[model samples]
Target: MITVERLTKRYGPFTAVDDVSFEVKPGLVTGFLGPNGAGKTTAMRVMAGLTPATSGRATVLGKPYAALPNPGRHVGLLLDASAQHAGRTGREVLTLGAILMGVGKHRVDEMVELVGLTEKEANRRVRNYSLGMRQRLGIAHALLGDPEVLILDEPANGLDPAGIRWMRDLLRGYANEGGTVLLSSHLLNEIERVADEIIVIGHGKIVAQGTKDELLAGAGTYTRSTDDEALMAALAEASIVAQRTPTGGLQVEAEPIAVGRVALAHQIVLTELRGADSRGLEEMFLDLTAGAAREEVAA
Candidate 1:
């Protein structure tokens, strides 16, 4: 487990991250989501002990990351795609990292293959690698030590659909085996698909944090299709808020069951009665981030 308790960071007059706090549990994929400049990278850097927080703390398995015995053996972090040495081949790079962490060369090859980078590509210079290949190489380095916790920032940035699916499955398996996974991404659809929980931040503060269901439950959008005039009459009588769309449909803001019951009494023929929260998560994220952005602009 990884715990972030009021983790804060500042640079001169600007606060990069402010009192950011969340916990990542084992056996679950926790997504770290936010807009650009929302301080996710700063927080992740602090958690990895690559950068110090100005106040508060981030702990890996109940101890400060730096204070852990062979911290590299307990936490694997891949922060950026451009972090590797250009002159070294992917294999050589991971081999050196493993050697420093007391991992053998055999283990290095295993991780490279696990990340889907063939031995031939691993033998090529990192500078010669494509963006996707380099991203995989970064993941390979992170897995070299077989750490219990993984922290990756935009690990899916350069991956194709197949590679992204492979990564999702790999991380899911890793968590299933009792590992902790923290991932940061801008891809909401992908995050919705893979994350068991999400921590959404904007302007250095958490705006939403919970399982997807919990977030959806708080929203007031649903889809209902029925005889239009009867549905309108029922909505008008109940004073329940609803709107007719340009596409000859009505979007309702009340409970689906309530809508259905009212429609039944009014003899409304139903064609579709599904919830329509297409941008539920997107709207939630924007609502949080946009407020912060406006505040920043005002300041």
Candidate 2:
């Protein structure tokens, strides 16, 4: 398990991670989510001991990561996929990692194949590998030690749809076999499909953290009626708050049954009524991180 308690990191006058706290339980995949500059990477770096925290602590398996013996064998980390040496081949990278982690050379081959890199591709220099191939190689290196816990940052950055699906299944299978995974990625849909729990960070602070079901339970109910305005008015009269969805549906802040009764009392014909969870993680993520989102502009 991974535990971060009130961790904070600062640079000069700027604070990157602010009093953040969260726990990643064993046998589960926890998705770390944040907009650009929200400190997700900084928090993960602290967990891996790459950066010293200004205050607080982060531990993996009940100990600071650096304190673990042959750390890679217990905690696998892939913070930056493209940080590999350009002079080395993909196979060379894993071989060196295996040596450092005191793992058998045979494990290198297993990981190379497991990540779907062709033998020919593995033999090519890292400089020649595409971003997607680099990601695969990075994943291979992370699993080289067969660690019980994996911390990966943006592992799906350059993967295609099929590759992403493969990654999802691989993480799921790893968790099923009792491995703990903390994955950070911009792919909300993929995270929704793979993660058992989610942590959302904004402005270096944890805005929300919970199991997928627990988070979605607060999404309330989605209702559509033949007369949306009438349904909206009725909901207001019942002291229930609601907002109009982009699709002209009312996102009622109440149970489906409650909304149904309100509509029935007003003799409004309902066309659809269900939990807003059907809207999925993207909507919830956007809502939680609202002003924290950074808009990108092409130079």
Candidate 3:
């Protein structure tokens, strides 16, 4: 498991991460989300011991990351795919990582194939590989030691649609097999599909954090009836507040059953009834981080 407690990071006069706290539990994939300059990368860097937190702590498996023996064997991290030496081959990078982690050289081959890089691609120099291929190589290097935890930043940045699907499946399978994954990406849809829990950050602070269901549940129920005005009046009478959505649906403050009961009692014919979150993660993300985007633009 990964635990970050009241973590804060600052450079000069600017705070990049601010009193952030969250956990990435074992056997679960946690999505770390935020707009640009929101400190997602800074928080992850603290967790990996790449940057010292100005205050508080981040730990992996009950110990600070730097204190762990053969850290790569326990915590797989791929912060930057392009950080690899340009002079080395993809295979050479993994070989070096394996040696550092005290893993067998055979593990290198396994990871290379596991990440879908053919033998020829693996042998090519890092400078010659495309962005997508570099991402694959970076994933292989991270998994080379068979770590129990994976911390990746924008691992899908250069992937095609098929490659993204493959990555989604791979992370799901890894989590299913008891690995903990903390994934940071701009791909909100993929995170919705793969992550069990989500953490949203804005202005270096945690704006939201919870299981996918819990966060989305607050969006409330959405219902549309043949006679929305009549249904709205009925809901008010039942002490259930509701508002008309821009799409001509009722966004209720109550559960689906409560809304349905009100409609049924009023003899209203319901055409649609579901959680408002059915609009999907992208909508919810936009709602939650609405001002953050404007702030980024202004900065």
Residues 109-192, model 3: lDDT tens digits: 899889888999989999999999999998988888889999998888899889988988999999999999999875577677
Native-to-model Cα distance after best TM-score fit, residue 229 in candidate 2, in Å: 5.4
Residue range 189-288, candidate 1, lDDT tens digits: 7777778888888878888898867766555545555577778778889988888877777877766787788788888887877666635678877776
The runs of at least 3 residues in candidate 1 whose Cα sits more than 4 Å from the true structure, single-residue gaps closed, are 236-239, 246-248, 265-267, 288-299
Overall lDDT per candidate, in order of appearance = 0.83, 0.87, 0.86
TM-scores vs. true structure, each candidate: 0.89, 0.88, 0.89
Error of 2 at 150 (Å): 0.7
Greater-lDDT candidate between 2 and 3: 2
The weakest ten consecutive residues by lDDT in model 1 span: 290-299
For model 1, name the residue pairs that clash.
Answer: none
Query: Where does model 3 exceed 4 Å of error?
Result: 278-299
- Candidate 2: which stretches are off by over 4 Å? 226-238, 260-270, 277-299
Clash count (model 3, backbone only): 0
Which of the predicted structures, 1 or 2, would earn the higher TM-score when compared with the native?
1
